[model samples]
Each structure stands twice: as C-alpha cells, then as structure tokens.
Target: MSRALRAPMPDLFLGLISGTSADGIDAAIVRFEDGAGRLRADLRLGRTYPWPEDLRTQLVALGQQAAPLTLDDLGELDSRIAEGFAQAANRVLAEAGLTAADIAAIGSHGQTLRHRPQGRHGDGRHGFTLQLGDPSRIAERTGIRTVADFRRRDVAAGGHGAPLLPALHAALLHAPGEDRAVLNLGGIANLTLLPADGAAVRGFDTGPANGLMDAWCLRHTGQPFDRGGALASSGRIDPTLLARLRAAPWFALPPPKSSGRDQFHLDWVETALTGHEAPADVQATLLALSATTIADALRATQPSTVRLIACGGGVHNPALMAAVADALPGIAVVSSAAHGLDPDHVEAMGFAWLARQTVLGLPGNLPSVTGAAGPRVLGGIYPA
Candidate 1:
C-alpha cells in the first residue's frame, strides 16, 4: 500500500516493556501522525520506572534460569509483574499530566521469561516464547484498552517471535537510496536490515549485548553495569577467551534467530573462561565479543549497509560503540537520537506504535525478520 493512501490512525498510545535486562519498565507515550506520505511518531513522554527490588531479583533469576520456578511461583510472578507494569503506566501518565482517557491504548510487551524460537529439540514445531504481565490486569488498572502477547502468534506461525521492532525501524529510519541497518543494543543485540531497494526488512538477534556485560560487571564490580564501559576500558581483551566466546553454536545460525538471558547468562560466559583470566580482561573480552559478533553478522548478511543506526541501553556505553565502529570500518555508526528518537526509549516507543497497529488491525511482524509464515496482525486486545 502507498504511504499516502494509508488510513489515518489514533494519535496517542502508551507502550510498556521490561527488556531482558530486567532493568526497569520503559514507558512511552507517543503521538503518531501521517506526514509527507509517511507515518511519523512523536514521543511525547518517556520514562523508566524501577522495579521493586525483590521483584527485580526474581525476574533476573528467572530470566537467567538461575532459579527454578513452579507453576504457582510463575502465577505469582505474573501478577506482580502486571502490577509493576500498571504502576509504571500510571506513573508515566501522572508525570505527563494526562488521564487514562487521553491515551488511545497501551501496548505492553510483557517481561519475557523464556524465548525458545527453535524449541528445546531444535525443531520449529514445538517452539514457543513466553512473556509475563497480564494485559487483562493492565487494562483493568489503567482503565484503557491494552495489547499484549505480541510474539507467540508469530512463533506459532514458525517465526522467532522476536526482533519485532524492525518494522518500526524500517518505517521510521529507512532511507530510500541508502542501505542502512538499525542495531538495538539492549540485553541482547538485534539488527534490523533496511535495503535501499525497498525490499522487505530483515532482523534477528546478533548475540549478547549488555546482558552478559552487565551480569559480569555486577558479579565483579558490584555495579549493575559498567557505566560508560569504564571497567571494560580498564582492561585488555583476552584473545583466547574472546575466541572461545565467539565459538558458541548460536552464532552460526542464520537470520530470523532470537535469544535472551536464558541462553547467554553468566554461566554461559563462565563456560568459556579458563579461570586464569582477570575479571577486567573478561569484561573487555565480552565487550569485544558484542562488537565483533555484531560486525560479523552485518558483514556476512548485509555487507552493503552504509549506515548503522544504533539504539537501546548499550548505545550509552562508549567503549562498546567505539568497538563497533572500529570493527565495522566502512560503516557509519550513529545513534537513533540523531534521527529524532530517544536511544533508550525506542523499544518502548515501538510497543506504543505496535499497540496502535493492533487497534487498527494492521500487521506488525515482518516475515523476513522473524521467519513467520507471512505478515500477520500481532497481539490480543483487552478492552478498557
């Protein structure tokens, strides 16, 4: 469909998501407009609300598969996460001086617990991805329509059910005559490939981003993260360790792949260690791994990419960004901020755009990105 002929859509939407980092709930209120034969999103407000300490600890443990969970435990965690998400929504709304009625709907990309796009047996048939935080509760608490569970349907259709933001990236960042890619450096890094020829967008998880780095940082420095990659900068990259980390089988998988903390936690990192490496060196090597893997993927899959626009938490880490730029010598590395989007809030804003898509009955996933059977409208709606 021509951009000029697209139907008008509701302007205001709230997006909520707690990424694999389990850092906090990112909430964004967006106003979308149709302009110049294209859709544009104006982020009216964005905020990250911290999780209750205990809830955060449990979430991290569950995400890393560090703690075993029973059905009852899962139920409790689900409700608590929903309550946390609801609180985040209300807080952002209050700070913006807006009532629930002022927004069109909420798009909640609930907290992901497990994401097995290829299933346990390496077959697509039994694959499933799970995200918690009940949208029904979100709708009830926020007194607004809600859209959640955005991934499972794609997984059911034989897709990875992740890297869902590529559609939004393509819509907002695609440059018609220049091959570009958007790299999201969240807990796990993923890339959205945008070809200059107007071909279908493609995306997938590249590998570990901040998730492993942060985990190792916290374990060594007692800091949640290495703030600006200071710790990593203080050490040298251990080549042997870096090589071992790079040899992980997942890295060999082709596109349409996805991963999470469940796959690349501290344990996964430890398995590659020789017990003689310094903590700082390990941190440095991990940072190098993220940069190298991202560069490798781009070179192997989209070598023609001229510009790489980066977003998400890792963008704030200068060491990582510099490493990426160094690794991809010919590509221009820039931030989404340069294009009018908040680096930290792009994913949250994406969910808001997704909510609007669900309300309009528009397809959200890119089959090329997720390996889904085809484009399909994502998410289930919970009316206010």
Candidate 2:
C-alpha cells in the first residue's frame, strides 16, 4: 500500500486543562500520529500555572455544592482562566520550537464547575455538566483554532460526561500484549483497564482522590496542598475512619460511573468527620481513603494478572503511593512515564490528542468508557 493510502500521522496540537482541583492550569503541546491500531504521542512541551489565590478561592466556592455566585463572577473568572491558559499555551509553543500558527489547533478541557451525570438534579432537570474556560478567548489570544467543551455532547448522548481520558488512555497506554490498569489520581481518582488481549476496556471513578485530603490540609494548615504528602505521612491512618469512608454508596457503584467535587469535596469530608476526629487524623484518613478505594476499584474492575500504571498529581504523594502499593500486593506499580509519557502532562496531552482526532474527523470518546451511545466526534472548534 502506498504511504498515503495507509494511516496518516497527526500534526502538533496543544491541550489546556484546569482540572476539578482548581489549583492551576496545565498546558501541553503534543505531536500525535496513528501507529498500528493506536496513536503515538511526542510530548513536545508542557507547563503549569498556579491560579491566583483570590481566583482560586472564588473558583472553589463557585464549584462547591449549592454555593451561589453571580453571573458577573462566572463571566469574569472565565476570561481570567482563558488568559492564563493562553499564556501557558504560548509558553509551551515557545519551548517546543513552534508557534501557534505552526500547530493544528488546541484542545482544551476547560475547568469543570459542576458535573451531574444521572440526568437529574436537585431541582429535577436533566443532567448537565459545565466547564468554564472561554475557548473563544484562547483562540483569539493564541491565534490558533481551538477545540473545547468536550463533555456536554457525550452527556447529551447518555454518557456520564466524565472519565473521558480513557479514550486517550486506550490509544496511548493499551499494552497490546498484556492486560493493564491505568489510574489517574487527580482531584478524584479514576481508573481505566484495557484487557491485555485488547478484549474490552472498563473504567470509572474510585470515589475521592486528592480533593478531600487537599481541601482538609488547606483548611487546617493554610497550604494549597499537602507538599509531598508530608502532613499525611506524619500522622497515622485511622482504620476505623477509613472503613466508614469506604462505605459510601459511590464505592458500590459498578464501572462506567463517574464523580467530581460534587460528590467528593468538602461537604463529603465534613459528613464523614461529623466533628469527631482531629484534623490531622482526618487528613491521614483521607489519604488512606484515596489509596484504598483506588486499589479496591482496580481489583473489582480487572481480572487477576493485570499490571497497574498510575499517573496524575496524586502519584507524587509518596504516602498515597505506598498505601496503594501495600493495598495491591504484587501488582507492578509504575508511572506512565515508563511508557514515554509524562505523569503530570498525560491529561493535557490527552486533550491535545483528542483535538487532533477532532480535526481529522475521528471519534474522540470511547463509548465503552464514557458509556455514550456510540463513538462520536468530540469538541467544538473555535477559529482564531
């Protein structure tokens, strides 16, 4: 077959993400190409920008359950986030020996404010998920076409509008010869398991990840996060509290489920505490809860003999990693970097690869993962 007649390689695309953690924004530039039933990526550049303290507080409040903020706040914050994202994208472009015009487009997974996937809300309306980063502004500021707002359409098609990264995980991390589980410990922990023989892929959220523990630390210690999880490592894990936390209904839900700050944030932790525990102990218990639940979900989702590779901000937490290693004996725990990908940049690169899929008119979401009706082209494009 002629080279043109065979699969084609995708050009460079940028991805911007401000996750549910609301701590900062990530910008990544990725080069993607078809490589024998999956896509290969060369992560050219990546950077992160911490959210301004005031904006961070406002965004956290905006995302909190039932917290009311005016339209002005939302609109202004959207612009601010877009500007930060644009600057980060430019930084990546400069580092990668490229410019905005040299790339195809950007794929942005805007900051998620709310994610309600059951098709009903407290007021009895259909399910809706909202992510607030202005794609128009990014496109205009960066002078590149942009593909963004990638989840609503899936929700419209009857999916959870989350755990969308599984599509990219399958494309990039699927070990064709072995069964493997890919876990991302972001604000919430989610896992994607690709059968070694490429039989099937199953994934979902494993309750909370760093969101609760981080929030607890910030509340008590005034730290944006538990640096190296030092606080958690110092305190002791309370098995009794960990048991009670694992009893939440979310843990029992089967695969194809998803969660966010809505279900795993401050309120959830507060409910779990009930004013009976010390803050330090609570932080340690929260860490245990994250590690144990993720391990439990992996066991439930995959058969025995599966290799486990973990990524996301939570992977840096030694306490959490140790706990996970302890919970799943003999399961090889490694970073996505072992597969030639950056742990912190995986999600951002996922969006970039997704944008390449969109530009080529390909399916960007995995129906098996998101539980959408079927494969559908994801994201809307905004031209510079």
Candidate 3:
C-alpha cells in the first residue's frame, strides 16, 4: 500500500463528520505538507452528502429525544451510518480523481448519538459520549486506514471530552498580540478563546446554535434549516422566552464544560415556552438566545477576548451573524474565511489534522481545553 501511494507521496487524508445538527455528512480531503516547522493543511476537495431521508429522520428523532436504543437497534444504526460515511468517502475520492489506495487515511468523527460531558451512573461520576458508526466498517469499506472515536480518551482522563478544536485553532489561527475566539456554531455553539498574551487556551460549549433553529424551521416550514435565518428574521424575538431559555443551569457553568443536541432539544426548549407563542417567534428567540449566549461567553473569558471568528453552518445565516455582531458591539465577529480556511470545511479539516497527529503518535488532546488530566494522543485506528 505504501509503495502504491508513495509514487505521489499521498499526503491526502479524508475527514468525515455529521455534526450535531444530524443533517448530513461532510467529507473533506485535506493535504498536509510541511509549512515552516509545522504541517499545514490545504483542503483540496470537500462535499457534503446529505443523509438519506429515512436516516436523517431517524437521526433527528434520536437527537431530539436522546432516547435509549436497545443494543440490537444501536448496532444496526451504527453499521448503517458507517456505510453512509464509507459511500461519502468513495464519492469524494471519485470527484477528486483519486482512489482509496491513493489516500493516507480517514479521520471519521462518526455521528454523535449522545454526548454527556458529565453525568452520573450507579458506578461513579462518569463522563460518557457516544459517536455511532463503526470505524472497522469504515476501514473495511473504504479500503483505507480509519482513525476515529476521538473523544472518549479525554473523558477517561476526567475531562469534558469536547470542544476539541482549540488546539487546531491555536495552530492555524492564533497570532501574537491579537487575542481571538473561535466560535463554532454547529448544532450547538462552542467558543474557544485564543489569548494573544500566550496564556492557556480556554473554551466551552456556549449552547444551541443551528440545531434548535434548524429543528424549528423544519417543523414549521418543512425545510431542513432556516435559510439565511429568514424565518427568524421575519419574526420578532420574545425577550421573556429568551430570558427563560438562558436561565438554563448549563449556561452558568464555568469553562471545561460542554453541551449537545442531546441536552438541548425541542422538548428542552418547550420547558421554557409559555405555550402561547408563535413558532417563528420561538425561532427568533432561539436565534437571539444563541447570539447572546455566545457573546456572553466571549465577554466572560478570563483574559478578555478581542475578536470572534465564526464558522460552521450557522455562519451562512446572515441574520444570525448580524445578531451576534450586534450583541458584541466592539468585537469584530467575522467569518473564518478571512483566516485562510473556509467556514464549511474548518471542522472537517480539524479532524483530518487530528488523523495526521494520531498517525504520527503526537498528542491530539489538549489538557487546557478539554480539562483532561494531561495531554494524550486521541483516536482509535482501524487498518484497511
């Protein structure tokens, strides 16, 4: 395999992830070559394969409920999701005029089924997270080495096992005397504070971002997401509902924390509603809630962040962007494209980078960001 790929020295690594929104799988092929002292990634090819309707529906239903699945059901769902990811990888390879044999490996984030940064069980204090989709299956199907299950190691080390991209941000975006925060507005929002003064990096989950808005939009308009946040734009925000939503106990928690679609679902949102509000109004408030929480988290950073660089699907929504910028009067809330990487590909690129790190046996988990006991190389590797 090495001899076959070494003709061109295959620097290509693929990353596949279905974010908390449960909408689709983003497959990215990134090339990593030496840049000065560190390896820098160039996203060569990227595409999102929308989940099949039935799988998408199941994902959304499971995400909203965070309900338990029997072992049999769980196994079947995992294998099916892995097949989707494998097909996506094949598609991207075809588009790029490459084959599985020409690639290095795949870093699969899988499909996050459940994430609890902290929870209780009969045994002891446990921090468990589940990302379904079998890496063995991915390796078998793609005929490429696969690296996945990137989070659990940190949890075992007593960390939150999330907000895993701050190290990537530091490597890719940090600049001297220019403190910045990377806000990943996926299904849920996670903010990473990169200090200019060379202080330790800090970040945590801010709360729901596109997940609730997308869910609401689908329920009301039959669309997968609120395009440009138009529905949210059309409706007025309900401050009372916004306040109630923010009043959730999770927001008050300090750093090294994280939340997920599993924690903040449609049912969770209903607890904040008074049962006498417009659906669009609820969506507007949800958007407002996301913006305000993100801003609040940014302001609360210990060293005080200067700029906010946004990414993920939410960055495409103009109304959400404007609201976040409005929430932070002086701070520049800008898209990540200004920093070199496309917003759509940043997270996928991170996973690709992580795959390289794992293959090199370098530490991928940041103790500062994840609250891990120490740095550890993350991910399980499955050979082709």
Among all candidates shown, the one with the greatest lDDT: 1
The best-first sequence of candidates by TM-score reads 1, 3, 2
Error of 3 at 3 (Å): 12
**In model 3, where is the ten-residue run with the lowest total lDDT?**
117-126
lDDT of 2 by residue, 104-185 (tens): 8999998888888775553325878888889999999899999998898888888888788887888778876778889898
Candidate 3 stretches with Cα past 4 Å from truth are 1-9, 66-68, 121-124
RMSD of each: 3.6, 3.3, 2.2
lDDT of 3 at 332: 84
Better of 1 and 2 by TM-score: 1
Q: What's each prediction's TM-score?
A: 0.97, 0.94, 0.95
Per-residue lDDT tens digits for candidate 3, residues 269-378, read: 88887889998899899999999998888877743667889999999999999999999988888999988789998888888888988998988878888899999999
lDDT score for residue 320 of model 3: 97
Residue 350's lDDT within candidate 2 is 89
User: For this target, which candidate reaches the highest TM-score against the unseen true structure?
Assistant: 1
Off by over 4 Å in 2: 1-10, 120-125
Global lDDT of each candidate? 0.93, 0.83, 0.88
Candidate 1, which segments miss by more than 4 Å at Cα? 1-10
Residue pairs with backbone atoms closer than 3 Å in model 3 (clashes): none
